[model samples]
Target: MQWKTDGPRSIPQAFPYQGSKRALVGQILSLFPTEQVPLLVEPFAGSAAISVAARMYGRAQDIQISDVNAPLMDLWRMIIDSPDDLLDSYTKMWHEQQQGENSLVEAKAYFMLKRREFNDTKDPAILLYLLARCVKAAVRYGKNGDFNQSADNRRMGARPANMQERIHGASRLMQGAKVTSGSYEDPLVNAPREAIVYMDPPYQGTTDVPDHRYLTGLRRDVFSETLQRAVDNQVSFIVSYDVVREDNKYGEPLADDLGLLHRNVVVGVSSQATLVGRKEMSIESLYISPALVQRLGGQDKIDDLIDVEPKTQDALF
Candidate 1:
């Protein structure tokens, strides 16, 4: 289906993922180069929401998706290259867990078995099932770098029919896209001049810490240096870093001397703050490279475009 800016809020998502950026795709796509670029690269491509949106909107002719998490990338590769096989495996596992009388207990057991298999053999389908049933669809890895998140137990993952549609939709949109498992550096540093590199790295607060959500922890200093290399190489890029809740910024801002322009796209109310009896708006900082800023009609012109809400959705999803 062709996605219009004013269409429904739900984008075609192969699987549920925490911090997927699916909600922000419209606003993010608005900032992409108006002319269709030859290629679009996503190094830290968790869910690859922006790349899917870019393809659907005809903003990119080719795409590259990479991540440090091999199993996650394997799942993405399956979604892109072999949707039917992946869905068949998921469907079988989804039905297998429904056989027992104690539904919840049986389902939890099924999830645990799949999680173990994913950690042991790194099966893409098992990983997909685990993410679908995991708590908050949040990815959590143990010190041994195994997927350790527990099952939600309340609902079965996406229905077979729904999963089928999402998998097919995402696969169709990303046909022929390159999928890889590697560090963010390869794509970021080697992006062609005609390519637009979109990065959503682990936030400063989450990185360089023990027992964090990500399997691989990134050092801020090292990440900054890599970004500098990209800038020095004249790569056109955009970064989705930390968020600002109310007037409080969550993480340290990127270095100012990197030759980039910064803007905050208001992402609506903070769920965390609202639960504590307070209403605070969350605004995400978007760092645009000098090349991209000029490509979009310089800083002043881009400011006017960024200030307006995306026509696709009335509020954050």
Candidate 2:
């Protein structure tokens, strides 16, 4: 299948992420036979970038995005259903915060402060936009879900301009797509048999930068059970995870114990303190039934997915 890139040149500037599958969506789509164009589902939709891009490329007919995080889901809904109101509210909050105004205080403040501290300014819209932009694109939180992280050197571009285009494009393309908030297992348990599940769970392991909260202990067993059910039901699914040592299985061995298809897709080099200078490669394990793999061809199709080039640096305040 032929593939074409769409959207603005500074698209990533608007939608920043870590280990985003946006670049590889094309390769994955290329592997997908034309007949399998629609019914794409992202069970763990962090930012929904992959599915959104898939729709933009005319690859999928419908996308079902689900996540357990309420705030993230709320943000997604606001962007798609009420972008104007959301942007206006965020903009007002941004300007007020910039002027040192403290009248606007609420759950939204968590997002605003995180963005400001991370971006080094008080532009609420830009901050909220950044919070929306990052991979999982989330603000780091503690056990209580309180935002508590300082921004690093990674600077993004103007928030409003890029956000407008992304929101507009995503909102239009996602007309048939549905976004929901719930456990990953819930959607899969209730989804149609023909659905394809793309799982990008939080990296399971220790991190040097202990700020971001990916997936916690809420439903670890449930996640594993869901994968098992997918395999039993002959559903097609792909799961991505961080690299871990054989000695340290972290309770559940990813490929060995989990019974995931043992195809390792090389990702970026790891910079984790424990694995510093260690090649830093990640893998995508396929765990659906063999019949499903045969129906979808094999790893050759998935191996073709590639990443797009990162956007140029710019001032984002």
TM-score versus the correct structure, for each prediction: 0.91, 0.69
Q: Pick by TM-score: which candidate is best?
A: 1
Off by over 4 Å in 2: 1-15, 31-36, 100-138, 151-157, 206-212, 218-221, 243-259, 266-291, 298-317
What residue pairs are clashing in model 1? none
What is the C-alpha lDDT profile of model 1 across 51-115, one tens digit per residue?
A: 88888878899999999999889999899888999999999999998889998899999899888
Model 2 lDDT at residue 156: 31
The backbone clash count of each candidate, in order, is 0, 9
TM-score of 1: 0.91
Candidate 2 at 315: error in angstroms? 35
For candidate 1, give the lDDT: 0.82
Error of 2 at 45 (Å): 0.8
User: Which ranges of candidate 1 are over 4 A from the true structure?
Assistant: 1-4, 208-210, 271-278, 308-317
